[model samples]
Structures are given as structure tokens and as C-alpha cells.
Target: MSKDFYSILGVEKTASDDEIKKAYRKLAHKHHPDKEGGDEAKFKEINGAYQTLSDKQKRQQYDQFGQTFEGANAGGAGGFNFDFGQSNAGGSGSGFEDLFSDLFSQTGFGGSASSQEKVGSDVAVDVEITFEEMALGTEKKVELYKRVLCDKCEGTGAKDKNTKTCETCGGAGKVHKTMRSMFGAIQQVVPCEKCHGKGQIPKEKCSKCGGDGVVRDYQKVNIKIPAGIEDGQTIRATGHGEIPIGGGHAGNLFITIHIKPDQNFKRSGDDIVSKVKISFSQAALGDKIDVGTIEGVIKMKIVAGTQSGDIFKIRNKGINREDRFGRGSHLVEIQVRTPENLSRDQKRLVKKLQEAGL
Candidate 1:
């Protein structure tokens, strides 16, 4: 049957192979007979189009020869069919059933892999940063001892960089197993344990990776700490984790930041809170004095009649706002110092004032 594969999938002719595959996956999921209001005929048509358009040579032939060309190419794939919903339930459908089975096993929706390549394990480490470091963005390098791609063999897992097809599963890299489950005897296509899902085998294995394509080694990873990052927040470093055995993607590195508390200053949101001690004379007479802050020391006015424990604000003296929308002020709580012992002259002056009041 002739079909406008692009129109059926609703993609432009200029779309890339990825776009075509993505469109096919979307339509296939929508029309799958298992879901409510599913349509079998429409599902078949979509699947048929994808089957022909996904392959490079076949796609090229179809694009040049017209829609009818797909039928000839899809002869094998079309002959094989299993009910999408029921193939797993209890049916022993043959041919394309196993193909569909493996396709569904991919991650997410359209995670295409010739042989299900596994993702590596993630690495996590806690890093401590000073309070000042939090205010200012900084970068840190962490020491890690973990699996990495083999430099000697370039992760080919072959000693001589050559391999023959695994004897167990041939070049298919999968073994069909008959197992008993709730449904009954279901034929399952699993990765060949011997070849580890690589269709071909290297003639010689790389000694460093032991044919697994990775080795446990030391690495120094550099991570960036953005300004205003809160304590105990984790930063994810992509592809910094362990190496996959079959030459796939590396996992991620998670960095948990711990901010060390500063005794002289406390952070309240974006604002810096602190306390300052002023002499009784300074507080009473309203003198200007230097107050220590994150932005060095700045002169602050001690207002006249400033009482103990009174809070004063110094504008733009706190942590700089991350958004660059001005800055937070330093909230300084004032503490007035009182002398415990008075000198004879001080006592006489105090007595004269008391007597005058009396």
C-alpha cells in the first residue's frame, strides 16, 4: 500500500531522522491497541511507516521511488505481527513479536539501542564552602576514585582491538529464553551474556579494562559554585560519574554543598545580620564609628539617644543581591557598654549631678 509517511506522521519533509523517529513513537503510543480508544488499523499504518522510514537505505529508496516502495521493503516486518496489548499476556506470536518486545523495553519512549546499553552508576560527595565563598562564586576541584574509560584500549574491551562474533548468540547479541511467568511460556529476547550485547567481538581485548571498557582510577573533578547558593543544596555534574561497560554514556556526579557558619556574621535570606558594641558616650553623643561587615569596614552613625539592643541599618553593606537589583543592608543590633567600677572623680561628678537634681 502506498502512504505519505511524512503526512501520516505529521512531519515536514525536511525533518531529520531523529524527528521522524520521534514522530513515529508518538503516534505509535497514541494508537497502541492497549490504550483506551486505541485503533489497530491506524497503529499498523503508523508502525509500517516508521519501519520503512527509520532505516537509512530504506528511507532513501522510499523518498526517491514513492510511497509504494515501502511495501517491498517492509515485507519481512509486516509479515510479523503481534497484538501490542496482548503479546505479553499469553500469546506466543512469532517473527516481529520479539522485535516489538525489545523496542518496548527501551527507556522513556523511544530509547533506541541495538543492544540495551546500560547507564553507569552515579557518584556523590559533600563539599564544604566558607560563608564568604557563598557570597562570592567559586570553583572547587574534588578528588574522586571511580571507574573511568580505559585509556590504553580506548574502551574497546579488546586486547588487540579486534573481535569476532560471540559464539553463543552469533552476531545478534541476544539470546531467546523460554521462561514460565504468570501468563505462561513467553519467548523473551535478552542480551547475550557472553558478548554483553555487542553484536561483534573484538579480536583482542584491552588489558586495562579487562574487556569491560572501563577501569577504576583517580580523577579530579572541577565544580562551580554559583553565588547565593544555599547550604546543603546539591549540584549535579553531568557525565562525571562511572563509565558504562559497553561504551555508552557516563553517569552523573552529585555535589552537596555545606556552608560553614561565620561567628561574626549571620545570613538571613540575602541579608547579613550582626551585632555591634558601642561605648555609652558614643551612643549618648551620636558619634560616627567603623562597623565591620562583609564589604570591609564602613563608617556608621550611632544616633543620639541610641539605647541598648537597638538595631541600626547600614544601607548596601550586606551581601550583594544575586539578581543585581541593589543590595541588602547590614542590620546591626547596638549593645551599650556600662562601666562596673567608677573612679573617684567620676563618682564625685555623678554625686554632684544627683545633688543638683535633689
Candidate 2:
């Protein structure tokens, strides 16, 4: 029986072109053979389903034939054979060549011509920085494990040798198989495992990288953190990730920033807070007091009859804005201190004045 292409990709029959492509990309990545616990058969099934659904003509025929399109083409075999040799025989004039190029490009393969330009996987790393550094921009050097391109073979996975056409798929790079299902018999094509979808095999494997085209080594990268960057923020560096297999493009690197807490200052959104202690006499009588701020100490005038726990705000003295805005204010809380011990003469004068009431 024919398999339901929509059901195979977990999409509805009326799914749009974008929806079909999205579903196929997700499923293909999940079930890719190189991934852990990936099922090659499931990946191939979805790939075939997507190939049919993504094409307007193929989708129309499949819909008319109840997802099989068994009579779309003539000859003993009703299905179309995606033969690369036949498709490329016309020298770029063939319709199948264009279609294959589009498919390969969307699937992360550089192009159909080489199919060996695979990019490496991305890497994520965590880093901690001081709050001051976050406030003022700083650069840091980090060390991590990355797969570097093979220096011995220059990422070719071959050492002083060449490669030959893959025998399993006959350089077509895919193997097609028919399966019996409830709907009928469905044909699916999958990557050739022996050549890893490259359609070619290396004659001699590299001694340093062992045919993988990458070597595990320690890598140091310098990352510049912008000013006013918030905690838990992430930054990406392009082409700084692991080296791809067989000399492809390198993946990106993701750096997550973690800001450390400060001892004297507390952060609240874009603002900062601090405590300032003043004598009781200074609070009773207006006086000039030195207030600590992130920039430096600034003189502030205290009003007469000022009470304890009173807060004073200094304009534009706090953390800078991170989202293209102005700077924030600094909030200072006042703590009034009283005399711990009084002289005997001072106590006598206070008592005499209270008794006489003069």
C-alpha cells in the first residue's frame, strides 16, 4: 500500500508549502543518521514525503492519486527515477538538475556539484564577568574544546591520495527502496551510508584525523563584551565553532554572559542603590555631605530637619542604558547617627534648662 506523505511528515493533506518544508526540516534533522539514536529509515521516509509535497506538480498528482501518483509517468515503472546522470546529461539544461540543486541547498549541502562542503556544528559556552566590566565594556579570552580542521590533510580526510565513486549507490549518492504499506507500495530514497551521502569514498584516509577531516584540540577565542550589556545575555561569533567534516565551513560559537554581584552597590533595572550615613547634627542643620556614586564621590546638600531613611536621587549617576536609552539615576538612602556618649557638663546644662524652664 502507498504511504500517506502528509502522515509520514506529521502534516495535514492541506498543509502549505512553507508548512511542509518546516515539518520536513525539523524531522530530517531529528532523524539524521549522524545523530544519536537516529533512525535512517524514518529520515528517508520523511525526505521522500517532503520531496513530493514541496513540488507543486508532484503534489497535485499525488493528491489526485491519493498520495501515490502511480500513473503520473508512463512506462512499466510509473514512478520517476531521480537519476543524476540522466538529469545532468543535458549539461545544466535538464529540469531535474535545478530541482536537485534547490533541494541540496536547503538541506545545508553547499551545492549538488560537490556535496562535500558540510559545515561543522555550533558550540555553546558559558562565561562570567564582573559587574564593572559589564558596565564599561571589556574583552576576555576563553579556552574551549573545538574540532579543528585537519592540518595534515587540509580537511580532505585523505592523505596523499584521491577518492573514487561510491559503489553502493553508484555515485548517485542515494538508494531507493519500495515499502509495502496500508495505502500501497511507497518508494523512498535515502543517503548511501557507506559514502555518508557524499557519493564518493576516499582512497586513503588521513593519518592525523583518521578520515574524519577534523582533529580534537583546545581553542582560545577572544570575545569583546559591549558596555551596558545585561546579565544572562548571549553573543554569537561567526565561523568560530567546530570544524566541519571533509573541509566544509566552520559553525558559529555562542557565548552566554553572567555578571557577578557587586559588594557596595546594588542594581535595580538600569538604576543603582547605596547607603550613606550622616551625623544627627548634620541632619538637624543643613550641610554638605559627600555621596558615593558609581562614577565617583559627589557633594550633595542635606535639607534641614532631614529624617533618617530618607532617600536622595542623583540624576544620571547610575548604570548606563543597554537599549539605546539615556543613563539611569543613583538612589541613596540616608542613615542619621546620634551621639553614643555625652559629657557630664553637657548633661548638667540640659537638666538645668529643663528644671528652670527659663
Highest lDDT model number: 1
Residues 194-241 of candidate 2: C-alpha lDDT, one tens digit per residue: 665667767888899888778999999999888677789999999888
Candidate 1 local Cα displacement, residue 76, angstroms:
26
Candidate 1 error regions (>4 Å)? 1-115, 172-192, 321-324, 347-358
Tens digits of per-residue lDDT for model 1, 207-255: 7787887899999999988867789999999989988675657888999
Candidate 1 residue-wise lDDT at 248: 59
Candidate 1 differs from the real structure by a C-alpha RMSD in angstroms, to one decimal, of 8.7
Q: Where is the poorest 10-residue window by lDDT in model 2?
A: 73-82
Write down the TM-score for model 2.
Answer: 0.61
User: Model-by-model lDDT, in order?
Assistant: 0.73, 0.71
